[model samples]
Target: MASLSHLNQQLLSTNTLPFTPLNSTPSISPPTIGFRSKSFGRPIVASADVSRRVVYVHAVTSDDEWGPDRDVPYAGVAVAVEEKPVETETDKLKKALVDSFYGTDRGLKASSETRAEIVELISQLEAKNPTPAPTDALTLLNGKWILVYTSFAGLFPLLSSGTLPLVKVEEISQTIDSEAFTVQNSVRFAGPLTTTSISTNAKFEVRSPKRVQIKFDEGIIGTPQLTDSLEIPENVEFLGQRIDLTPFKGILTSVQNTASSVVRTISNQPPLKFPISNNKAQSWLLTTYLDEELRISRGDGGGVFVLIKEGSSLLTNQRN
Candidate 1:
């Protein structure tokens, strides 16, 4: 018998019915009970505010079923990686020159492109590292240098064509003393039946750090016929004696940068020329390139000599 309006208000205040506008339909939901403490058989209900509070929770999956489609938020700032510096022109040139010398093929030919490249590199290097004259220059030349390239007109044809019958050069040493210098060259040549060894000695003077004068003094030629199994020929007796062969004299003039030079010398006397002739000295520019272990000198007439240090290998060791 309670009023209908009063009953409706009671239902709405208790949350049993949802409030709506006058023209809208009323919404109904299941009844919610507040959590209460239990003592023996009786129940003590909690406050109405506690029952009205709503909570939401999100669950995270432990499996990888949603891994590909999951949206992951980055927790760190982005960073960039750095790169190495580029090589300089000088470094590239140096590498190219070294490759030309110690590369697969042993020697650089006079007319080849590699030789031209070497010449260009030498010029650039000399310009960058200009060496002073006299003291500094002579000190630099003190060490033993293996000849890696040479172009002396006299010896090139014989070495290239293998017509001189020379088997190998045992040793070629240039020793500079305080007052004088000596050049000793030992060579082994193949004879008709056996091999003969010959040693040539030359004395020189360092006129200045940039200039040198060389004079051929004596030659110790071995007797190949004596060692041969065949009967000795009467005409071969000259090989036994230490012949006072004709002396070869020449002057080498180096440039200020210590990179190239010019040589004025009489043509070397032929091996058979006894009582050597005093031929007029000829002048030619010699383009010289040197590092710690190798020495390359090219003559204007297209002769090349490749010499290496006494104990060094052609490939692994090079001048710094």
Candidate 2:
């Protein structure tokens, strides 16, 4: 904790990124609230019960004109048949951001240097946002989005400390059912016994070309799901050093063996629910960037969120 604080303080002294809204323009206002994290406790009836509402998944093609640079041969045009590798500055920056996230633990473990780089890249990407008015293109917002990067400090502690000392955040995602005019944000946490989640479901009102007012109506404490297996990483690097997990394999295996009955009992129960405190839970989201796969939005106070559509190549791409 001390080291993490020191790193942040040092980074602050050297850089102003993340603190200032990246590429803020006068038309947009900084968000008063940050994205919900551990604070959103309890559950109520969801406005758009997605459990019953089907979110149809379909394959998406490139929105760009390049269409993946493939080669087609006409005997006379051999030269034109060669496949071309055309990468834009945006492409490079996107890959760079992903690489920066390599060991950051979703910004929790990010070093001062890595944080600065991430903020810079986010600003650059915002400057080139293809669709500045995201609300204008509602069709692209119709599916699950996996949050890849965020400077919303609220989630950092959750990502760092977690719900319990040993619990870790598995995924933080947002599902938008455009047809139903609803949005659901959920964060999943994993523990030794079972994996569970906390979520908020809200109805969104389009206020402007790029802005949306989200009124959170419900929160849910998801039912615990038993883990299929005890999957441990081969090793982890701590304090610039790699530590092997082989020594702890026996201990983990022992825990996995005892997971049967208790885990099953918990999984059979229903998830809990509660009504949202309308005044505190509502917030404005300004879409600075939007496309078929990637989305970048800022809250009323400037907390930045970068998300990738579930089936996006952005998630499947190779990273350094």
Estimate every model's Cα lDDT from 0 to 1.
Answer: 0.40, 0.69
Q: TM-score of every model?
A: 0.40, 0.63
Off by over 4 Å in 2: 1-85, 163-165, 228-259, 317-320
The prediction achieving the highest TM-score against the true structure is 2
Model 1 residue 48 CA deviation in Å: 70
- Tens-place lDDT per residue, model 2, 34-123, is 111111221111111122222211111112221331222111111112234679898888777777777766676677898898888888
lDDT score for residue 196 of model 2: 88
**lDDT per residue (tens digit) for residues 119-188 in model 1:** 6765665444334343235544454544444435465443443344534332334433423456555555
Q: Candidate 1 — number of clashing residue pairs?
A: 9
Q: Compared to the true structure, candidate 2 yields what TM-score?
A: 0.63
What is every candidate's alpha-carbon RMSD to the true fold?
Answer: 28.0, 25.9
Candidate 2: deviation at residue 121, Å?
1.5
- Clashing residue pairs in all predictions, respectively, total 9, 10
RMSD of 2: 25.9
